[model samples]
Target: MRVAFVSLETVSHRDTETNQRFQTVLEILAARGHDVHCYCATFWDDERATLERDGITYHGIATGLEARRSFLIRLPFVLAASSPDIVHVHAQPPAAVLAASWGATLARAPLVTEWYGDGGIDDNRWTRLAANRGARILTPSELVATWIRERGADGDRVETIPNPVDLERVRDVPPGERVDVIYARRLDEGANLESLLLALAELRDRDWQTTIIGDGPERAMYERLASDLRIDDRISFAGDCSLEERIAAYRGAHVFAQTAEHCVFPTEMLWALASGCVGIVEYHVDSSAHELVEGWDRGFRTTSEAELADAILAAGDLEHRTFDDRFADYDRSAIAEAYLEQYRTLEEAYGLL
Candidate 1:
């Protein structure tokens, strides 16, 4: 299939969960012999209009990410010239998606939008119009799907496709040193690590150790909070570790706690779960973290420090595991096929097949 993806800024321009998700998925599809092309503002060093990387081709619609108006103005004509079989566009900067719609129309292709709730569509004017022009919308979680629907997308036109992890990678890495608890994510304003710190403070009398993975500007603040709670001694802040290091930590840890203020998808939680850690998530009004743990025996959802602390203790009863095979359903290959399935469905429905 010839797939044309539209994004004003891709992972290269600004790394976000949504952009990285599409990059991984599209690269996977491209590796499988599909003709995948991403149309976005250029990030490559050269003046090349097109660049190839990770099995997919990239077409620069504008000079840089800052050229939003230029990207929108020139995107349709560029995509139309390419004439792909299906057009995939990002939900962010809804203007880009709307422009891609015109290009899709010119190429007689179906337009699909992916909205991860990371950004954009807050105003809703373009979101609604983007949906009006696109064939369908894909989201990482139902929380995001509901968000798009509330903004004026048809319920039937929006679908939930969870974020995926490279499960094979998880299975290959050996477990690291054993730890009692784990929390992973960029320590930003939404880190909410204090909640977990408070929970751990309450359990200070217990025998346990912790490893806080990832780093950000607020790392010092979280460390201070942990110190204020008198649990800093037990917490180790491993700054910005690699994927293997993270997977090892998750595999060795008995419990993984997620207390973020908000996230469209619990990506790290999924990795920890697949690595065999008991998943514990604290719910937030803007967060969809609870969705990942709703129905699983190894998962726990709590809303308070008291509950989170208690769940950590309760997880001790469960046997430790190095890995869980169930999450294979959310592996990269599964997600790649899901994307193709969505594309094929659109093709059949729109008579594009």
Candidate 2:
């Protein structure tokens, strides 16, 4: 099968979960003998050079003030030349959806758009129209699938396929000396790191250290908050780690805390869980973190600072646990097969099979 993937950027960035997911799927499809072509924006100097890797070809679209105009003008011609069987687009940047839709029509191929639960789409008519233009829409969680449906997408066309995790890379590492409590997320206003600091402050009597991973515009603010709360000494701000470093942090930690609100199936949380860290999420009205711990014994959903502190204090008891089968379905291989099934279905429906 010939597949064309459209996104704002390629996985060469490797900075976000969305890019990683696309990279994984491309590798999987390419390994399975599918001709995969990725069309994405070129932001950095290195991104301007086109190349082929892992049996997949990547074409970087132009970037600048006229990027949208350039992409819209060039994409249809490129798609027509490639003549792909299906065009799979990551739905964001709004312009990508519009351009990909047009390009897919020109190529006479099925269009499949994916929403990675970034909260960029709402009930706006234009957003709904772009989303509904796809022959199928894919989301990373049930919460996101529901959101798309409410925004006027057909329920039958929307499917939930969780982000794939590299299970072998994330699981069962030998723990370091200290039993660390870890919180990893963008240290921005929405991260709600302040709540985690307050909760940790409440447990001053407990003998546990925290390592906060990740960086954002509000990193300095979070650092000051930790100082003002007098817990700065107990916390370490290990900003933006490599994939290996992140897995090591998760494996070394005895407990992992999540305080972000409205997160849609955070891949970090999944990594921590798969690394055998005891999971605890501070409850929020719209938080999807609770879904990770819904029926798990080693996980907890705390409603208050005191409750969170208690959960942390109790995390030591869970140290004996190892990565289990709870998240087996999210393994990269399993997710790749799921995507292949979807692609085959679309091919059959389009009479390309």
Candidate 3:
């Protein structure tokens, strides 16, 4: 089947975890003998167009038209060239969907969309119109699905499909000697990292060290908080380390913490679990942290700094060999296969030939 994946989100050549998820899916689909084409915003300067890297043909949509205007200018041309069996769009706020839905209509193909986060929905009329035109609206978690449904998408059209995580890259890392804790994700408004910093300060007094990975607008604030907390000496800001470095952090760290208020599918959490770290999840209404800790003995859900401090202290003492054994199934290959099953189901249901 020919699948055209239109993503308005940023795609870095740096190979961040977020980008890796989409890359992995593309590779998986290509390996399964499906024709996959990625129409994504080039968020980097790496030059190599229409090349085969991970078993898929990648076409970077060069655009200066700002995100809001991108759908209007590029969708028709992309649809004309790809002529896909299915039009798969990533993210929402119906502007892109509206454009893609129209292109799919023109090409006589089904439209499928993946809504990854809590982007506000203001155009109810347009969203409803688009939903009626779409074949399926895939979400990464039940929480996200609820939000999509509230925005006028039919309940029957929603499917929960998470971002794929490759566990092999994590499970095979050589054990490190340092007792490190990791926090890897975008440092944005939704991520309440102050609590983690305070907890780290408390743990610092107990001789614990933290390794912060990832770059974002909130990095400076977090740096300031670390300094004010007097734990700067014990914390290391790796600032958006490469994929190899991320795997190393997972292997080196004994505990992983996430303070995000609305996490959908945190790639770091999956790595921590696959690498056998004692996972510390702070509960928030919009987060899928609980789902990450579900059925795992090494994960703890907390609501306060005091509880987080306690969890950190306990986490520092967990046996790595045992914890790794507990989360062996959370590996990447298994997650990829699960995604394949979802795609296959969608293919059959939509009669993609």
Leading candidate by TM-score: 1
| lDDT digits (tens) for residues 1-353 of candidate 3 | 78887766534544444445556667767777778887765554567645455566666665422645755567767786678877877644466787887777777677787776644334467676655446788777787787778877889888876665555655555555455678888787776889899877777657777888878898899999899989998888888877766777777788889888876676668766777678899988878777878676788889999899999887766686412544444444555566556556766776763
Ranking of all predicted structures according to TM-score, beginning with the best and ending with the worst = 1, 2, 3
Prediction RMSDs, each to the true structure = 1.3, 3.0, 4.1
Ranking of models by lDDT = 1, 2, 3
Give candidate 3's TM-score.
0.79
Q: How many steric overlaps are in each model, in order?
A: 0, 0, 4
Q: How many backbone clashes does candidate 2 have?
A: 0
lDDT string, candidate 1, 172-256, tens digits: 9999989999999999888999999999999999999999998998999998888988888999999998999999999999999
Candidate 1: Cα lDDT at 106: 86
Predicted candidate 2 versus true structure: per-residue lDDT over 184-281, tens digit per residue: 99877789888789999997777778999999999999999889888898899999987778777787778889999868777889888887788999
Question: What is the RMSD, in Å, between candidate 1 and the native fold over all Cα?
Answer: 1.3
Better of 1 and 3 by TM-score: 1
Give the runs in model 2 whose Cα sits over 4 Å from its true position.
11-17, 42-50, 60-65, 171-173, 285-287
lDDT of each: 0.88, 0.80, 0.71
Error of 3 at 254 (Å): 1.5
lDDT (0-100) at residue 8 of candidate 3?
Answer: 60
Provide the TM-score for each candidate, comma-separated: 0.97, 0.87, 0.79
